[model samples]
Target: MALSDIACRNAHKSDKAKDGKAFKLFDDKGLFLLVKPTESGWGKWWRFKYRFDGKEKQLSLGTYPEVSLGQAREKRDEARKLVAAMIDPGENRKAVKEARADSFANSFEVIAREWGSKKVQTWDEKNNRSKRMLERNIFPWLGAKPIADILPKDILASLRRIEERGTIETAHRTLQICGQVFRYAVATGRVDRDITQDLKGALPPAKGEHFAAITEPKEAAELLRAIDSYQGSLPALCALKLAPLVFVRPGELRAMQWQDVNLETAEWRYLVTKTNVQHIVPLSRQALAILLELQPLTGHGRYVFPSERTPSGIRCMSENTLNAALKRLGYGKDKMTVHGFRAMARTILDEVLGVRPDFIEHQLAHAVRDPNGRAYNRTAHLPERHKMMQQWADYLDALKQGAQVIQFPRQA
Candidate 1:
């Protein structure tokens, strides 16, 4: 017989402590109200018992009073249809739980960390810089939001806030990193599209002033002399001197490892962190001499310019080490920057030394296209670059000795 709503509500606790049992009332279609004894009174729960795929299972429709008799029978009838179709309602419940778990694992913070772990493999600033960029600029706004649900406007709004702080370059870089995160999410099937694409032309134009470089031969000669006179730590002084000769990025120069430099072969080979490519820097004789002189001091350690503040000397010098040294030498930010070394080398190598532009660009590790519009190999133009690098070093030495060098005429 089917149960009535009145009977479920009137069900009272029975003191069956001696038997250690409770009473159960049955309804049709395997629906029943379990009257279990509680400390205060009787507790009634609705349960449906059925068989699916030759095995019996039970589905809890919820408690009684909360889930009345009519509601419990409706659930039982719906579950019965699932059983008739060879499905288990219990399995459906488990599947729902698994889907929810998967969604949680795909949250923005979770996936961003996953992508960061892989990216930090090639990073040189020790991953702290990139991590901080995300934490400060990207995370607070969108970290908890679902990656798929983050539209272009949300990303644009986040970038606009960064731009308002006067760090326009940082704002651009933050947007780029966000795009990488979105692309990673897309590849992993977390999001359907990289909405950052819609944000083209969304940012203010960046200021076009190149890093302040001493492109004039006389001015560069003076700068080189000043670096030679810098009374700083041996590591700091050596890095300052080598910056102009190698013309690599400041971070790459500071993080140089002794293992990457082969003084005997006059070659320094290391992976370029910015481009994710292996670059070979042919050591000019002048540059090699500085490395040889400094090797005994830092060769025992991992870095060519190890941190002086550290007794262990295991870590590389900080990014600001060279800039601080320049400031100490009376060169302000407007006068010269650490990265200005690359521009200085590029200008003099072309205008003063008459080196081929392609050779110079390849040596500087700039992404350049061949006549066929293909990326020049990292090691492409080795023979020509090797010659150009030597000429550049010799020209600098001549200029340092007060030799008057004539600037080459630009070809039309």
Candidate 2:
């Protein structure tokens, strides 16, 4: 028999518990709340179960009196509307809650992994170094914490720890990396804003220390003379000789490949230089001679300075290789480093050789100006530069042999 509201109200709970079977009552024509008995010392439990979209779903509207028969019917109608639209109300509710949890649970390490895989494609060598330092120092300290929960105080504390070790530069670098990570978090919608912005000027400034080098001309002459007598391989000897003539950064010189050099044309093309511009170094006669001698040994390899022991070719010469070679001739970092060759050339070529500062700066791959008062590729002076390079090398050679100094062109 179909139940009525009067019958549902009259249906009282028996003293003993009933199992499996439920007391069913209808508040309307097709809607019902089934009250089932449990042996767990509770009065009874009610579930509003109905069919929607050819599927059955139950909405637990609470025990009888707590959720009246009328209220259960209303809840059932709302759930039916969700099902009519092909939506599972129960599952949809759970999904919303889970998404909220995931956003709150996002940590620095988790976001960094995503950034490394998806976001770091355009990052250059310098950016990679910054990222590496962050992974090594900052990540281990605060990576697991939720990005949202990280405060300015927490960041300052982390930097304070790094500063305690007396690496002021490292602290600054770590903060920069941290700032980038926070910005990445913002870009991905993980954080609302970067807390690292407040951290600017918060940490102690790094000491202004120039890269160690030897700037004296006579000392550089001795160093060049010693390099000429180096018992190393021909490529190493040639790189050392060209290091002064070209005055390119050591990494740039070591990374040079045969494809970049044009021996017949007396030019070396740098496609990707430190300034992120194409650079062309016009080779001097002395530089060409060095290349001619090196061609037989490392000409077939990919790198101009290939490691003698490896068939796969050198990825890069060791950073310490040039410094160690200098050490062999009783010179330390201060006396004459590989990089000092640039300073020596820039100093002498300007003061002694009377080469225009602008020309010397351009030849040294430093930023310089054009006739239009705008920055231009200094390689435009290649013809004049070629002559200047040969003259510079000849002058250095004369100084090494204790010959009388030749008059240089007056500076414009």
Best by lDDT: 1
Segments of candidate 2 deviating more than 4 angstroms: 1-132, 142-158, 174-196, 271-273, 307-311, 370-373, 406-409
Model 2, range 44-100, lDDT digits (tens) per residue? 344556665687776565666676667766776777787778887678768988976
User: TM-score: which candidate is best?
Assistant: 1
Look at candidate 1 and give me any clashing residue pairs.
Answer: none
- lDDT (CA) for every model shown? 0.83, 0.73
The TM-score of predicted model 2 comes to: 0.64
Q: What is the lDDT of candidate 2?
A: 0.73
State residue 97's C-alpha deviation in candidate 1, in Å: 9.3
lDDT of 1 by residue, 1-412 (tens): 7778877777663343335467778898888888877787667888898987788778889997888788898999998898888778889879989977776688777788888887754333443566678889888988887788788899888898889998888887888888888899989898898888898889987775467777888888888888889999898998988888899988788789888888887889998878988899998999998998898898899889988777576678887788889999988778899999898888877877777787888888989998899998877978767777788888888888889988776432
